[model samples]
Target: MDPLHAWKDDFRREVEEVLAARARLRTDEKSAPEEGFGGRIADLVIPPAGVYADLREAVAKLKVAQDEAAELRGRFDAKDRALEREREARERLKDSVSRLVLALREERAGRVEAQAEAKKARAEAEAAAAALAEARFDADHAAAKAEDWEREAMARLRGAREAQAQLDRLMLESDAARAEINSLTARLEATACRAAEDGQRAEEAARKRDAAQAAERAASARLAALEDESRAQLARCESLERANQRLAADRAVEAERLVSEALVRAEHEARERAKSAYEDGIEAARQRVEAAERALRESRAAEAEAAQKARQAISALADFRDRTHAAMDRLGERTRAEREQAEADIAAARRGEAQAAARLAAEQARRDAALEEERASLRAQFEDARAQVEEESDAERRVMRERWQEQVQALEALRRGFERGKP
Candidate 1:
């Protein structure tokens, strides 16, 4: 083929491509439905031209097309710059979204941590409540025990008083027996003297003397029996006193042992609980740190991927630059309008995101406040319960001590009374 013909054919193909590009741009504009300048640009139609008669004419037309293509290329470059700015804006929006997502994830993590802490606090509160209940129960049990001891002591006192009364009655009986013996001895002496004076009635006097002697013997036997009974009663009293002393000693020792055991057990449990809590906290902190490191790595990877995608888009746009010249001419005004709309849309989206973020923040703050308030209330309740338990325990102890003292005093009084009556 002739060289000129080949040139003409190439020129024709370029023109056709330009026309196709224009058609495609018009179609794109129609699809988007712009108005005013952008609309007019899209609506403008280029008529198809007939084939040129000669090479020179075709060359001149080709030169004109080249000039128009250069202008289009310049406009395409401007549009490309605008597209780059829009891409930057999109990248910023994506970064904002990523930050928002990261923030939401952090908020979720914080919420989980707070919930865990709340759960731990609740468990601690429950443990404290159980301990308080146990303490109250122990106090009640001790009080009941003390009351039982007091009742036993009182019963013993009543028995001692009755024994004392019995001893006094026995002593009175002994005194009467002794008086009778003395009177009998005086009567016998009188009868014996009268018999010595009256020899004629010696037989009657001897008989009377024998009867008197029998009566005196009977009186002496009765006095000996009374003396034995008194000695036995005194021995019984001494045994009872020893028993009372032993019971009081046993009770004191038992109370001291119980208190010491309770204190040691409580101290041990508290130390164990503290150690467990500290270990759990350290483990939780370590887990959180690991999770944070993992999240940071993930975020960095995501950022790098986003940057890679942006670079790929830039390379694609650069590749499209040559083909987009014809379409760029028609797209100039449309791009500006689209940019404004995109910016407005982005602003609206940003505003919406900001509002959502604010609402989430407010909700988070409110939840934190509520959790704090609940924690404070629980702490106060626990403290109050602990104090009440302590006070009740102290009061019970004091009461027990006072009762013990009273018992001791009563026992001493009994001992003194027994001593006074001893002989």
Candidate 2:
């Protein structure tokens, strides 16, 4: 198939033909001596000396061409070795590039995961913020309720104090009334004893009636004036009794109202009225006692009747005191009950406020802990993502630089191979 091989084949055939012809000549010379015609024919067929010289020159050129070809072949082998090394280097570069690409993909995946985590952190933070806001709102609401409860408790406490003061006043008035009743009872007993002691003296004075007629007229006039005063006092007592009844009815209504509403204004007004009524009743009783004393001193002829009237007055006063004591006792019981109820309500409200405050504090603490933990987690994630990105970037830059250097070296090798290939 090759031109060089064909040429070699042709040269080999020529050398074989020459050698065979020479061998035949030797055989003929040995077989027949002094063959002049055969020798002359052989001499005629053989080439000239110049022709041999030309053949030798051609042979030397062929040897030089073979040496050149051998040199070319050696260079080609060196080129092939260089090419093989380049191919191996390219394969290594390609493998490195594949690995780099895979690393890049993995980095991208990591970035995506980091982004997702960051997003999740943001969502959780937002949720925490919302929960914290809600907790704050609840705390504020609880604070407002506690304030309202405190205000209500204060108002109720004031009311209870007022009621206690009223009760004290009533107790003092009751004590004063009892003292007055005792004095009235002693006066009544003294009056009855005086009336009995004067009974015989009054009969003895009957004979001297004419002699004491002028004195009796004066005493009767004085007695008339005293009677008018006693009548007026009795009317005043009846009016006072009617007023007391009205006040009692009003106090009853006010007490019921106070039990239901617990309004400060209403309770205050009721207390003021009851205090005024008590004061009025006490003043009336003192005036009646003074009027009875005046009547007893000025009316000598009517001393026994006066003592009887005094006894009735004492009886009425005792009855009034009993009624007042009963009313006061009932009012005190109701007031105590109301105060107890208010205290209980206040205590319950305070307990509720305390519970709410505790819950709010716990929620605030929990929210703070969650927020702090979330912040720390986010900070750590941010640092890790930043570090990973920096490492990947550095790796990519190094790979690119190495690849560029490899490409440049391959190009230089190719240029040198081309230069060596030239004739």
Candidate 3:
């Protein structure tokens, strides 16, 4: 045989053994022989009919229990499927959350880079302004040097003009030379004034350049500081990203663990349900067995009662037969006695016989009536016992159902709690 088939066969054999054990248990529950005055008498006589009826009822109850056990087995299968679905859902949710965390970290990094570039651009603009101011100052300084040379030339031209004027006063000087001197002096003074103004403007431009350079340096220093801050921020962001990744990993692990735990819990719940059903089946079977035993006991008691009644009837019949024989014997012996004695004895014997017959008849009637009463009593007792048993069974079933419902509710609440805790 194939291994699978062998395993199946083994399972079937185990089930069959269980069923056979149950059957044997039921068979052993057959009523203990009724023990009472009536019961003993019943053993010696014909049995009553009520016994069969009780047995039939017990058999019916056993069938009901078998059906209930089958139903519980079906419910176990459904619970197994539900638990598996819950585990799958939890795993999917955990994966989704981890991916979202990674996306968020990437977005934050992009923002930090953009902010750092803006700060660098602001620093460069300040440096360019400083360089332009320095170039303007240099141009002004060159113009000032050119102006000083023109001033010295104008001073020499002025001295030459004064000598010419002195010569004109002592001995008539030339008109052309005087005119040339005047023109040279005027051009020289104009150059010197223009140079002096350029020098002053150059000095002012130099001061402005220096101030601008200082401002540029200060701005650059601030920009460098900002760059350093950005670097630090970037580092912090990297750290935060790492931390976020770690947190995400931790969350994933935690989620997986939670899913695993939920799966375990679901499995545990399924097991608990199976166990509870098994226990319920066992308890129901036990109650059914107990009821069957009680019924059997009642049946045996009734049978014993019927047997006792039959024995009583047989005893009465036997006594009647003996009395009749004794009367006949007396009749035969009467001839040997005196007439008066025989007559009186015969009359007394006849009366005695009649009394015996009447008593026998009455006893027969009483026996029938007692048997009826006993049967009625037995039926009433049986009914009462059956009713009490049913009521007790019902009460027990109700209590068990309530307990089972409470357990189911608690399990459902636990399932809900697991769902709530899930990511």
State the lDDT of candidate 3 residue by residue for 1-423, as single tens digits.
121233335557978999999889666544343333334555566556777778788677656644543443233233324333433443343334333333333333333332333333233323332332343343234334323433443343344344334433423323343444455445545555676667775565555555555655565565556555544544443454345334434543443354345435544654565566556655765675566557656865775577567656644543342213344345334322444564566577657756765675576567557655655665565456446544643564455346435534543453343324321
List pairs with backbone clashes in candidate 2: none
- Highest-scoring model, lDDT: 1
Q: Between candidates 1 and 3, which one is better according to TM-score?
A: 1
Question: Which stretches of candidate 2 lie above 4 Å from their native place?
Answer: 1-44, 49-52, 101-116, 185-423
Candidate 2 lDDT score relative to the true structure: 0.51
Provide the clashing-pair count of each candidate structure: 0, 0, 3
By TM-score: ranked, best first: 1, 2, 3
Query: What's the TM-score of every candidate structure?
Result: 0.56, 0.35, 0.28
Candidate 1 TM-score over all chains jointly: 0.56
Q: Which prediction has the highest TM-score against the true structure?
A: 1
Clashing pairs in 3: 41-308, 42-307, 42-308
- How many pairs in model 3 have backbone atoms within 3 A of each other, for residues 3 or more apart or on separate chains, i.e. clashes? 3
What does the lDDT come to for candidate 1?
0.62
Clashing pairs in 1: none
Q: Rate the local accuracy (lDDT) of all candidates.
A: 0.62, 0.51, 0.46
